[model samples]
Target chain A: MIHKRITKRKIIDKLVFFLSSLSVIIAMIPLAGVLIFVASKGLSAINLEFLISLPKPPDEIGGGIGNAIQGTLILIGLASMIGIPIGVLAGIYLAEYGDNRFGSLVRFMADVLSGVPSIIMGLFVYVAVVLTTRSFSALSGGIALGIIMIPIITRTTEESVKLVPNSIREASMALGIRRWKTILFIVLSTAKSGIITGIMLSIARIAGETAPLLFTAFGSDVWATGLNKPISALPLIIYRYAISPYANWQAQAWGAAFILVSFVLLLNIGVRYISRERYKK
Target chain B: MPHSFFLFRKIKLKKIKRILSGDFIFKNITLIFALFVLSLAILVFYELYSRSQLSINKFGLGFLFGREWDPVQGIFGALPFIYGTVTSSIIALMIAVPISLGIAIYLSELAPGYLRSPLSFMVELLAAVPSVVYGLWGLFVMVPWIRDYLQPFLESILGFLPFFQGPKFGIGMLAGGIILAIMIIPTISAVSREVMLAVPNAQREAAFAIGATRWEMIRVSVFKYAKTGIIGAILLGLGRALGETMAVIMVIGNRPNISLSLFEPAYTMSGVIASEYVEATQELYLSALIEIGLLLFIITLLMNIFARLLVWRMMKIFRGAKE
Candidate 1:
């Protein structure tokens, strides 16, 4: 008998296996390349002066994205206020009372909404808010981000709420409590951690968004005040600087990118750890 | 009898009851909140339709097929952009699906447990790396590499084909497609891996009990079992590549012309709108851009619905099996 039969099928199987393994190795290259390059280049740009001071003129040497950092925070904060309530409430509706046609429609819309190119959301906000306001505002940027957040948060909330077993809800309902009370007090509390994770994920998503805020925020040269005037954001600044002819601005762009990437990556890692621990429970 | 009596009393009391009853108020409000999702789409459509009326009226149905996009002549058409969007997304899908499926297979069925979780996490990290960062990398690292080596190499080998006939500009449809494929790999792979994992272990055992090799077992049991889910995952990836803005905009060279050649500069629907919308001061031009946005919105929405239908079908199958 043959000690090792080298049949045609065996050779083909080995080849296919090798190719699959090779493909996964190739896919890992991009993640490693992007992370290493961004971190190394951006690390030098992060200093006390860069973080705390206002931007210098394009021709100048040292500047910070302080205004942009503040603007991004304000924009995110405002967007959260607008988006989280609507998203969480709609999610609650889907979880608690969404056994009908409207629920399915909302679910469908949520999927479609997430698929909308972020730039379109920007345009919608630009037309709906900026045109009415007669100027670009943080309000418009918030509106754009808030719109983007709705679908993500809605889907996450629904999934998490669904995870709370029916028996738990039944127990709550069997008590002398109203349906809404049972949902709000019992089911929602059980799902709070998951819902929060969803919110964090949404924030991480919109935080790096540049296309949606391009026209909505319209960029600012100086420290802008309030939500009326145009505001600079971390992503908008990165885009602007990355395209500029000046080297210093480009450096600043790298620094800002480092910050943005670190923030997003850390948030994602944190959420994953939390979710994994919860999974073990 | 008591329940019926209470229901009758409640029905009678409803006319005199305050409208602000907690149950009624909360349910109707949340329902209204749910309806906002539908209204968001409708409002976007209405806004786009009303805003783009001038362009819609001027170009009629010809706008979709007309090729010229010269804002200087006040003429606008979306065909090239549509071509670029469709072709680039197709390229992304073609490149990404196989590799992602491979990764899914490796991660789920082949990789040992010690290696699997970290590898999966790393892939997920790529998804969180942000599009702008991807765009930046594509511009600084990939485009130059493509221009210098990849395109020239491909052109030399495949020059006889029309698709490789363009001049070697690194930032073009090919570059855009590659970047998109990278960005989408994590998503498609993760979803496909989940689908593969959901395939029962008995199938693997049964396949092994036969004379099935590793690849053969996966192909017959895991892959065939999760085929619909994998399709849904690929479609979702396709939808994502279609709507991706900043990364594609950066790498696609933003030329408003269509050609069969992947090496030439081209524009996508989202790419065009992103770069041009803010500067499009002309009435027809702005309206035309908005109209393009409307078109993109419709396309992606449809794509998503189709993908979701596949996923829903998969869920039904799972439930049916469980029962």
Candidate 2:
């Protein structure tokens, strides 16, 4: 009787355990579904014309989103230019001279900034930048995106910097080297891989952000070359197209989604590779 | 005489070099930049406050709790959006926390080694997927599916419950919560898994030696040991859900109403601001949205601090126990 009861209990335990694991495995469907669906459909829309052509009117069957692609590149490029230097400097402070309370406070604020909703950041930039500029501009949008990027870059830089051993710093300092030179040459160089990973990852994240751009860069159905004019981006275009009443627009929206997802995915994969390489070293 | 003059000049140059070293400049510059980072909060607060003076004077404290937001008449209140924000996020947390904890437990103790990394990677990938994609998927796929299938099934079983009763709308608090839950699950589970994995092997061995089964051992010792970190993980997830914007905005139906029915459409603070900030013609309307942003900022800030404290405390305990 005892042996039979033990066997039954074991069976129950095994069943529960397996079911729990299966639930997690099942969760992968949504992720896989998105990648597969977007890739197949998005690939169809990625011909030469699609890459170079402007968005067509609602009645048109298959025009491209060239303007949006260019605008997105501009915004992301400007965002990196503005965010990278400041973020790296701030990160240097946290890692090197971060024994002080102010350093801790900055670190904490950066963490909080990371958690703040992207839309809230957009509203902030809208009020601070777009309203002041008197019109939506690519510059304002870039700044807004930069604000979103800053916290991520700062945090990642700090983590990467911390991973570098302090013995290098001490050795340089003992050689009568300046604290700054030691950090820049010895510490930063050592942590360069991780730092690069952080930058790439932050870029990937900001590229897909739609909310902030909505309020700052905004929508322009036409091509944009001026900083003061409203700009088009993939995320914004997707948002607009997805919500349109037209079926063609919906397909375009799917294509836009595919482009945005792939862009982010490739960037993420690159970042992971860099981080892994750093780990291997 | 020439030699004496050269020695004096060399001493002067060395003095200058010592005073103006690259180390001194680099450290000071870094320190200044760090100081600037904290000062951004003040800058944002002051700038927004100055710009919002007109609205603040117009709406005063009544703006926050007022139910109506008629732009033409210049009436503005944020009660409904705030209500929706808290309710939907709380529901998301309630649903996500248990499932995430279960997944964490399973990944930590039950899963085969081969399945572990891939499963973990997939969950993390879900997190890395952008909010906008989530918004699109939530609208096109999840929302319709829920409306067509899940709603009928849920209402059939729980129809008597006030929260479950209503029309099966394609977008509403329930849909938002589900999407939010899905978005945050990976965050919670990944962090929770890290915490659970960090639990000492000795503790598990002790539990096992006491004749505890594998499941019991995990429940009693591993989970107990990592409870604070687990709490931190949940809080972190809650923070994400509370501040989620694009996905919620896409599917939340943007109705500014305080209702008990989960099937009814509602508006989150982030969603309201995202949808209306561009078209907000009135000063009060604009400032009211800014205030909502401020509120969100403050809430997220507090949650992050709490989460950091929890994780720090857990680390200390684990370290202390080990030492």
Candidate 3:
């Protein structure tokens, strides 16, 4: 007997689901609050000069973020130099040559490493690199960030390479290609797009990292020159500016936030674009 | 000439076999390299152990139970930091978990298809925002809001409870916990949403075929199947919360006090390390910090292992059952 039943359980269920979804929406408050506040106050200052000027003193009401922009680019470049090749190679080994116990172990380790907190990695770098050097520097920060990037790239590379079909590998082998040559010439070419997405995501992950850079790179308010000295980056600059007593500094902090957010969002979009391109072909 | 050609053919076959064996060797070498990734864990543990040995020897196990940290006279205890870490993380999870679960359920079972992806992506974007940014927002906005409104309101009502006592600083454990909750919500929501989405539609349909309503069907089918996955997600968020540094340090008002009051200033393992790892001068002081690092590492490591096992076991069970 099928009855049209509006049961108590049904009412409770709907209520619970509604509450849950509403709370999720509620959780967005802090982020939305921050973004709107920053945009209104920070948007007006996002001029060419703000982008170009080095941080002036607290009294200097308007200044640009030239040093910060330059430092971030250099750090990203150094991090990629250290991280991408090693991660790609490691991933290649796992995907192509990894059919054994060691491969499984490596894959597991990479996952575990990926789960490790970025702060711990920074601490590790500090103890191993920074303390020994006896000073904070961008190289140290880049290395710390690179440590965080490696596992991300490795896992993405492995997964991307694994996605390439065995048929392709077999075809290369049938042509009498050596195994390594088959992997390099055929497998990597197929997996390059996904690998690029992984790299971009890794870049995004490191770009927002503040903890690792805190003790390692050590922020500079002034323009930075070499690897040995402390450098100004957007995140560090934001932290400094946000915490200061001055109102103008606080406004500048919001501008820096806009810059950092834009970079991360662009990286996210870039990954999406690369992945779409791969699928289209 | 025929005999010589046969000999050459034999050599060629042997060479091919050797090349195949070399390929096998190369494969094994890759596996070895993968295994080397674990060596990082080993390396971290070893470095922390040796570096922290002095503190361990000096304080013995009592250091963990000890309640004071006096850097001047070399007397140190980690009880307060330990307490701060556990309490704040627990508080953050308590606040974040329910809200995150609600979000996951809403996105998976309630939201329209077009809205799900964008909505979920927006939530994950919160995770993408740097901790330092959160720190800035918390210090400038949240802290002030708490001091101005939330703390006063909470204190008047919960005044009997010590956790709400003392004048509001806008930068104490309560504010820290609230900030941490904001940070962890996206993590839990993201993972739990994936798990909830992984639940089979067939099971939901089966429940509905028995005249179950939408909510009842989800309760009977999806939630049951995804229980372990949800748990793992929560654990992962907990692990992240435990090791969070920059943001927590910025607003946690780092004083090593073991007050029951949530408004009191406190220091976490990570917060302490980030704040002081730079100027750690004395050997014992440095080792003390490393010991704290080691402790935090161990806690997070165990949490991660638990998360991995839960995920692995659930996946294995589900896949095997499907097969």
Report DockQ per prediction, comma-separated. Answer: 0.71, 0.59, 0.56
Clash number by candidate, in order: 0, 1, 6
Q: Which stretches of candidate 2 lie over 4 Å from their true place?
A: A1-16, A170-176, B1-19
Which candidate tops lDDT?
1
Error of 2 at B303 (Å): 1.9
Clash pairs, candidate 3, are A50-A64, A53-A64, A102-B31, A103-B31, A106-B34, B163-B262
Candidate 1, superposed: residue stretches over 4 Å from native: A1-7, B1-11, B14-20
Model 2, span B145-202: residue lDDT tens? 8899988998999999999998798689999998898889998998899888878889
Best by TM-score: 1
What is the C-alpha lDDT profile of model 1 across A1-281, one tens digit per residue?
A: 35355375578678778877887898989988888878998998899999978888998889899999999998999889888989999999998889789898898889778877788789889878887887999988998999999999998999999999999988877887877888889889999889999999999999999998987998897887878989998998888887778888888888999999998988898888889888999
The CAPRI-style docking tier of model 2 reads medium
In candidate 2, how many Å is residue B180 off?
0.8
**Among all candidates shown, the one with the greatest DockQ:** 1
Candidate 3 chain B — worst ten consecutive residues by lDDT sum?
B27-36
Q: Model 1 over residues B1-323: C-alpha lDDT tens digits?
A: 89999999998788557565677788888888889987998998888888889999999999999999999999888899999999999999999999999899989998889999889998888888889888887887889999999988998898899998878879899999999999889879988898788777888999989988888899899889999989998988998898898888888889988888998999999888888877788888989998998898888878888887887778677767656
Query: How accurate locally is residue A100 in candidate 1, as Cα lDDT from 0 to 100?
Result: 89
